[model samples]
Target: MKTKHYLTLADAEILMNRAVELSAQRSFNMSISIVDEAGALLLMKRMDGATPLTAHLSLEKAKCSAMSRRPSKFYEDIIRNGQMGFLTLESVTGMLEGGEPIMYEGQLIGAMGVSGAKAFEDAEIAQKAIHDFFQQIS
Candidate 1:
């Protein structure tokens, strides 16, 4: 029988490792977090210089991404333009920064989050991780 969800143990490992590599290369130590489709923690890493606040934010962003099944940075754009509707939706949605959903076969299987640097930088690393994920499978 064909396998189920696109996510696999190997995928998880590659994603986590890529996050670490990007974090190091950027010289922005961070706390990285991943969550499954159901918004459950998968794996997390805290670099040497990551701040305590990064821990919670990392998880929050990962959770937000998983829940929204969209790049959390998109919300940043909405907020930047002063979209109060989107801001109020935050009360009902898990939207936040630093997280992005992981997709395969056009389906979301998980999300990733990184914190420590600026929100955009963290989002960049997360985006690289996601891009690398698709590359790993392709």
Candidate 2:
């Protein structure tokens, strides 16, 4: 038997609302997205002033994170350190931060993405949403 896993749309929206609140407190318009276990789109939103492009890039970054099962920043580090593997990794380098895998029962269930601000800020928003949402999950 397999334990089913994926972030439901309601849960994704709950997380996104928290993200919006946090970004609003900091006055950042953001692009946010949540993808399921297969890295398929689930939910997405763009704040009032978020640029249109952020929507696309944010989703892709999240997909990259889910596919790699690691924070996007780690890849950023590898490239910044001039690792040879990164030479052909440009296609995977959204290492710009703000992407995280969603976990349930110690397994990767999905991922979240955020953009429309600094890389660190986007990362922070995604982290906060994950923390807050999971607190109510189990």
Candidate 3:
């Protein structure tokens, strides 16, 4: 059998809290989602005043990022460049900027997604949270 790493509940909580803290700092009511490498939802939160839709969108974004092992912006850029065919890819929805893969020890273990703000701002929260997480672990 082969070995694989996965995000624990504690790890997910740290990511969620960091993302929420970042969003709060920006005064942006946001939704955040964390997913394991297999695109399984690990934890999610929707800040007060954030739209309900943000919760669902954040989950999809997390799944996309975890499964694709790349920032959701990569797929969004492809569609923006007229590569509409990308939209037809199987199980590859949520092609937006807020989703980013989470890596540890040079391996992708999960992903994080943020919503209810500008696309770039959402991406910033996810990226910053992951950066802080890695710093803490290091």
Candidate 4:
């Protein structure tokens, strides 16, 4: 038998709260999404000024990171470097940046996606939130 780690609702809430705080500090209105390792949405939030499109795109970015076990930006970079075929793959979407996989103790537990700021800024918010979440928990 093998032991596996997964995210609970409490964990998701912590991540969300931290992300919201970070966004507020930066004066960014963001749409945030969290997803399990299987790319299923667990939690989502669209801030007051975020666009409706950001809500949907945020989830897709989380799905892409969760499903691929890599940052969504990975796909975007490959595509930009001439791997246009990545666009045809149906396993993932939201290949633009801003999605970050959540890993704990070398185990991939989930992912977080943020939108509304610049693409790299969105990615920074997610990455920083996840980093802070781990620090608080650890």
- Among all windows of 10 consecutive residues in model 4, the one with the lowest summed lDDT is 84-93
Q: Which stretches of candidate 2 lie over 4 Å from their true place?
A: 84-93
Candidate numbers, best lDDT first, in rank order: 4, 3, 2, 1
**RMSD of each predicted structure:** 3.0, 1.8, 2.2, 1.8
Span of 10 residues, lowest total lDDT, candidate 3: 84-93
Name the lDDT of candidate 1.
Answer: 0.80
- List where candidate 3 sits over 4 angstroms from the true fold: 1-3, 86-93
Write the candidate numbers in order of decreasing TM-score.
4, 3, 2, 1
Name the runs in model 1 displaced over 4 angstroms: 1-6, 85-95
Per-residue lDDT of 50 in model 3: 100
Best by TM-score: 4
Task: Pull out the clashing pairs in model 4.
Answer: none
Tens digit of lDDT per residue, candidate 4, span 18-38? 999999999999999999999
Candidate with top lDDT is 4
The list of candidate 4 runs beyond 4 A from truth reads 86-93
lDDT of 2 by residue, 53-117 (tens): 89986897788788878777777777778773625444754565888888888888888889999
Give candidate 4's TM-score.
0.94
